[model samples]
Target: MKHLTYFIIFFSSINLFGQVNYSGFIDKYPIELSADINTSGNSYGVYVYTAYDDPIVLEGNLQKGKLIFFEKNSKGNKSASMTFEKFNLDSESIEGIWKDLKNGKELKITLSKKNEIGDGIIQKTSIGDRYFRIVADDQNVSEIKIFQKKTDKLIQKLKVDCQFRGVHCISTGDYNFDGITDFSIFESSYAGPNTSSLYFLYNPKTKKYFESGFSGTSLEFDAKRKRIIETNQCCAGSSVTTAEYKVIKNKMILEKERCFKWSEKKQELIERKVSECR
Candidate 1:
């Protein structure tokens, strides 16, 4: 019925244990599924309808090019089963049959490997002059392609190591405060608000983006002030660090830093250390 252009990945033990994310439709209804099969053919993951966002437990096995799996309800009762007659996790797309174990009705199942980060959503900006694309593979790897919009010519392609797939997995900005916009890909995240990204700064001379070794924890860019700020928390949020940097020739130079310790008595952050570049 309702076609959804975006979907969220439900992280569980399956995702943590390295499952491949997939997106497609089951009888014209958008669905997202994450699954992986072990060497012994044991399959596991979660399936969800984009409209409802309810996760159904999935478990089954792969046998002789056929993947047979069942969806279990919240009550642990088997609701339906699916058989991918020519199951190949590496295939671009898959077609199969879904059987309702209770009602004996059938529905056509079609699925394709999904990219957690890119979905052709960011194509109308200044860079839209080029057809930009980000494709993620089964190995948590992504390839970025920039093509000439008018001639459909490919400009550049880069390999990147990344994880997850969704809106939060990609971002664009001018990290170096340059007039041209740059982009970044999410790498990983730690506890609290601490996270990291791989930045690709725009290069005017080369007409391409180059991966800058610039990295920090929870980075924030201040275009007006021309400064980069990094916020980090540790020790169960009892300690905090804030570092300020200035972009010098595309490299971040540390300018000043301050450390704070959580005060248990006053229930506030107490400044512990302050330093500046010598």
Candidate 2:
């Protein structure tokens, strides 16, 4: 598919996740915050200053009545931090301290609630042996939660690097052929049945899910053969490509590929070429 990339839309004001929207000042710099506090006391959100063009991702936890958030840069590194001594959702305004990790600079933060959306619950479904619920607005998925199927115990939570627009589909398979099921989310759609997804594989050693950087177009897992099939079609279905991959050390190793071109004479697709990947 098209190169995997995050599509960030600019908005002067955001109602992200339809959960918590705030307008605030960070030491005289105007800022807007859109966030959600999950039931497990974990928080994930984004904030942007009026003078900036991009938003900074914030991830943290609420513990002992304090909200501690770390500002994540584009590379997913914590560059700064914010700790609110007293944060109450019902409160109109709250205060906090912002600290830059690199320069050791500190600033006062004060935010006033601008709006509140009802409990953010975009979709809930179960796959394999886990229950998942996505917390997001109609535009984006901010957090994904995994719960034990039998006990309903929250096992893991993650923030994905993709957007959810319309119908969101989650797929699962034995990607590594390790018995445990791995899952993925549709990332985006492209021309003529071309799409990409973000894969999260189950790690039995850590008992957690890890995001896999596997890239392919419309990947389909063949559990019986333990292979991954990537299908791509373009040019009004006239050009097509299919690739087969084998999992080697938890990585996809391409083995075979085939190309097809539509033939007007035969009124069907004809095999154009075939090759093997080394």
Candidate 3:
């Protein structure tokens, strides 16, 4: 009857329904976390966690995915069930629509190929839907996608350069001092010395999305009409970072903050939040 978050630890354990056995025991017994997992193949895996505290560890070949969990007694009786849908996809995919569903969350994930983790954008839409995006490796990349809902099809896809590998977990709701909700992404390719590359792009003006900053991965924020602030490498050992945006006059400022302690309050997230950030 207690609430304790459990991280996912994958071992060569027994495979129940096919997929990697990313399961572990939480401090509390009978704790289950609900997650939605997707991959390059149609066949995906859903990890039913017994806890919701700590971290969700994913090793080896990983893909864009989430987790859902449930609990039952020794008599095969069901208790509570929850789903943690965290991935970066087009705004019109099923995962996008589900993000707008009831009890949705505002979380981000790092997309990866094997061991290389790519950054993604995740924001709270006006109508509760999640606005997630990810830039390609370079300019040849096309179309930045936003997930309108978890189960709905991709609704909005903006064609943009692939130069930046960010946009994974950001908000398009005017985080900067710009008037419109411009798309912001962070690309961190520099990992050599004490410096990192960071860049911010805005589209308030016609055919002008080039912002000023270094190029590297970052936690982005959109304040609708303020400034564009990018936080590179939110913290050490931080799985995902949330970017905070605000608008003052004509400046955009971004910040990285921990998630709100809204255990059950978040369940009441209204659809108005993600109404028109497409």
Each prediction's TM-score against the native?
0.55, 0.53, 0.27
Lowest-scoring 10 consecutive residues by lDDT in candidate 2? 1-10
Where does candidate 1 stray beyond 4 Å?
1-126, 274-278
Computed on alpha carbons, the lDDT of every model, listed in order, comes to: 0.70, 0.69, 0.32
Highest TM-score model number: 1
Residue-wise C-alpha lDDT for candidate 1, range 104-195, written one tens digit per residue: 99999999876553532122122545544456554354676666644546688878877644323446888999877898877876776677
Judged by lDDT against the true structure, how good is candidate 2? 0.69
RMSD of each: 12.4, 17.0, 18.5
Per-residue C-alpha lDDT of model 3 across residues 160-250, encoded as one tens digit per residue: 5433322122333443444444555322233211123223445444534445442323433434434334332212322222335554443
lDDT digits (tens) for residues 60-129 of candidate 2:
8776679888986767888999889887877889999999998999999999986543322322224555
- Measured with C-alpha atoms, the lDDT of residue 24 in candidate 2 is 86
Clash total of candidate 3: 91
- List candidate 2 stretches off by more than 4 Å: 1-124, 127-129, 148-153, 165-168, 274-278
How would the candidate models be sorted by TM-score, starting from the highest? Answer: 1, 2, 3
Candidate 1 positional error at 60, Å: 30
